[model samples]
Target: MRAADWSTPRLGLSELPVIEVPNHALAFGWSSKSGPIRRRVDDCPVASRDGPVRRQRARWAEDRRSDDAIATLIVPIEVGIGLRRRPIDDVNAWLDTDVATHLEG
Candidate 1:
């Protein structure tokens, strides 16, 4: 689906400030070795495997160039080994145990 092009968006008066229009956003927290990492393969072919030089970055900010109030939604989940539905408690425990051993599994 796409935005309807039937009418033009009017930037007129409003109670909410323009900068506060989009006062929300989401940010995904991936491992540093995954993303937000510099493409410095030249510096070290296996720079990613050379221990964590940079920690996992799950940060958010309002870019000085834009008025969008981006908000970060970071949630911690368990890292089980097997493919099985983990219990709600286990999922939020942040454990790295095998899912198969779980009672629910």
Candidate 2:
């Protein structure tokens, strides 16, 4: 994760370095201010990003679902991935909805 992308609340405690699990991590116990909590990541997808993920992921997300001749990011901030923590096809829609056109003066 990049500097700007990381914004998780900080937790202070003795921690072990991140290591590859033998098979999979069932759960990790952690002591918090409230109490002890267990972490369960059932469908965590770990990917190796070569470059800036935002621009790349945005384009790739649309391409994966769009069938149109051309796909572009008209309104970058408004349209984005889905609620399920995966890329959604919000970029490539019908021409009318995708972009706004005005007649020349």
Candidate 3:
């Protein structure tokens, strides 16, 4: 199997940090002021790079299946070891319908 490219706008979350089983995916639970949510991704999408440490902004948008609209957006303003939380300002900043899409499949 091959890893998915991460250098494109289609990429959302950061590189996952854990052991992965081939052909399987994982989802992590996150909390916010509204309630709790989950972020799911296939593990075969992270790319490897070298050199000095670099930082990348990781943002998440949740689109409700009912109304086909985004209900929550989370952006972590601060990060720590195994813990991350987004401030209200950051959430508001990145929350928008910039990527809304409709597909006929």
Candidate 4:
């Protein structure tokens, strides 16, 4: 349950200033107590890319993260029960939740 707010990105042709490209950057959100909370985090533009390619991006991104999360979940669970419930690689879930909410609203 961690996240970071990155500065927006600027995209355009050198000469043209009419069209605005949304941010298309990824970022990491971290905290000392909770390690590796999420990844493939998006900047403002990248997040907004959902407008057109939202479903595709989310499907692919979430599948990737779910695979990673499952891999990581194994080690921690095998180690001990204390770490079994810990959250790991949750960016996909976070993204899905956000996108769903946005679409609903």
Among these predictions, the greatest TM-score belongs to: 3
RMSD of 4: 17.5
Better of 2 and 3 by TM-score: 3
RMSD to native for every prediction?
Answer: 20.1, 17.5, 16.1, 17.5
TM-score of each: 0.19, 0.17, 0.21, 0.20
Tell me the spans in candidate 4 whose CA falls farther than 4 Å from its real position: 1-53, 70-105
Against the hidden true structure, what lDDT does model 3 obtain?
Answer: 0.28
Task: Estimate, for each residue in 1-105, the C-alpha lDDT of model 1 and write its tens digit.
Answer: 111111112211132111112223333634434323323221211101112222342332113113442222223333333212333233323223432233233
Candidate 1 has a TM-score of 0.19
Ranking by lDDT: 4, 3, 2, 1
Q: What is the lDDT of residue 94 in candidate 1?
A: 27
Estimate, for each residue in 1-105, the C-alpha lDDT of model 3 and write its tens digit: 222232221334354233233342222432231121132322112222221222321232322422444333333322233212223334223433332222111
How big is the positional error of residue 79 in model 2, measured in Å on the Cα after superposition? 18
State the lDDT at 81 in candidate 1. Answer: 30
List runs of model 3 lying over 4 Å from the truth. Answer: 1-67, 81-86, 92-105
Which is the winner by TM-score between candidate 1 and candidate 3? 3
Question: Taking the tens digit of each residue's C-alpha lDDT, what string does model 4 give over 6-59?
Answer: 111122113311222334443342222121222323211122121222333445
